[model samples]
Target: MQLENKVAVVTGASSGMGHAIVELFAREGAKVVAVARRKERLEELVASLADAPGEVAAYPGDVSSREVNEGMIDFAQKTFGGFDVLVNNAGIMDDMSPVGDATDEKYEQVMAVNVYGPLAAMRAAVNAFKASGTKGSIVNVASVGGMRSCAGAVYCASKAALISLTKNTAYMYMADGIRTNCIAPGGI
Candidate 1:
C-alpha cells in the first residue's frame, strides 16, 4: 500500500531496529508516531528525521503498560486523525540462561515487554483501524528464536507465542481489511 500521507505508529522507536523503521517510514511519506520509553532518544531521532518526506512525533512511554499503549494510540489519532499501520517492535531479551536457571523476574520482564506489549498494541490498533474504516497493516518484529529452539528457553518461548498470536490475528482480521504479518529476524 502507498505510504504517502499515511499514519504509522512504531513502538520501541527510540533506538535499534524500531528507530530505523520509523525513519524509513517517514522517508516514505508516512507521518510516524514514534513510541519508546526514552523521551530524549526519541527526540533526537525526530530531530535527525526533520528533513524526511513526512513528519514525526515522539511519544515516550513503556509499551508493556496497557495504559501507555492505549494512551499512545489515542494521542496518535488525535494528532494524525487516524491510524494506518502499526509496528510492534518493542522487545527486551534477558540474559541467556537455561530454563532451570531462569528466574521468575526475568521471565516476567521478558514476556511483559516482548509478548504482551505487542498484543496490547495490536488490540488498540485494530480498534482504530476499524473505526477509521481504512485498510491497515500490522508488522510485528519477532525473532528467529521463535522459529527455532536455539535461543534461551524463556526468550524462545515468548517469541514462539508471539508468532502464534501474529498468525491467529492475521487469520481473524483478514476479512476486516486489516492485515497482520511478522518478521522473524535472525542474529540480532
Candidate 2:
C-alpha cells in the first residue's frame, strides 16, 4: 500500500496506456478517479477493479473541456478528501498526413485532445494541490515522436508543447512541494 489513503486522478483511463496506469495505481492503493469520454468502457474498467485495495470511480467527460477538468478534480476532492497525484494521460493521434496536406480539422482534433486536454487537467490539479497544501505529483505521458519527428507536424508539436508545459509547471510549483514529470515513449 505505497499509496495508502492517497487519491489520484488518471485521465484517458478508458484504454491503452491510460488503462494500464489506472490499474497500477489502484493496485498501489490509491483511490483512483478515472476520467474518459467513453462511459461504458469506464464502467467496465471500474468493475474490473472491484477487489483492488483502492476504489475506482468514473467521470465520463471530454478531457479537452476546462469545466470537465475542474469538475473532476472537485469531485475527487469531495469524494476522497483531496488529491495527491494526477496522471495526465489523455491524448489522441490524428490521421498521419504531411503538413501541407493536413486538414485543419485533423490538426484541431489532435491539439484539442492531446494538448489542451492535459493543460486543463494540469491547471485544475495544480490549483487543488496548492489549496490542499499537499505534496503532489503529476505524471504526463508524452511521446518521442515529439522529439524525433516520426509523428505528423501537428501531433508532434502538441506533444512537444506538453513536454514544455510539464517542465514549466514543475518549476512553478516546486516551492509548493509539487513535482511534475513526463515520460516520452519512443517508437510504437
Best-matching candidate per lDDT: 1
For model 1, give the 10-residue run with minimal summed lDDT. Answer: 1-10
Q: Which sections of candidate 2 miss by over 4 Å?
A: none
lDDT of 1 by residue, 129-174 (tens): 8988878999999999998987788899999989999999999999
State TM-scores per candidate. 0.97, 0.97
Quote the positional error of residue 172 for candidate 1 in Å: 0.7
For model 2, residues 60-137, the per-residue Cα lDDT tens digits are 999878899899999899989889999989988867677988899998889998889889889998889888798999
Distance from true location, Cα of 34 in model 2, Å:
0.5
Clashing pairs in 2: none
Candidate-wise lDDT, in order:
0.91, 0.90
Global lDDT for candidate 1?
A: 0.91
Model 2, total clashes:
0
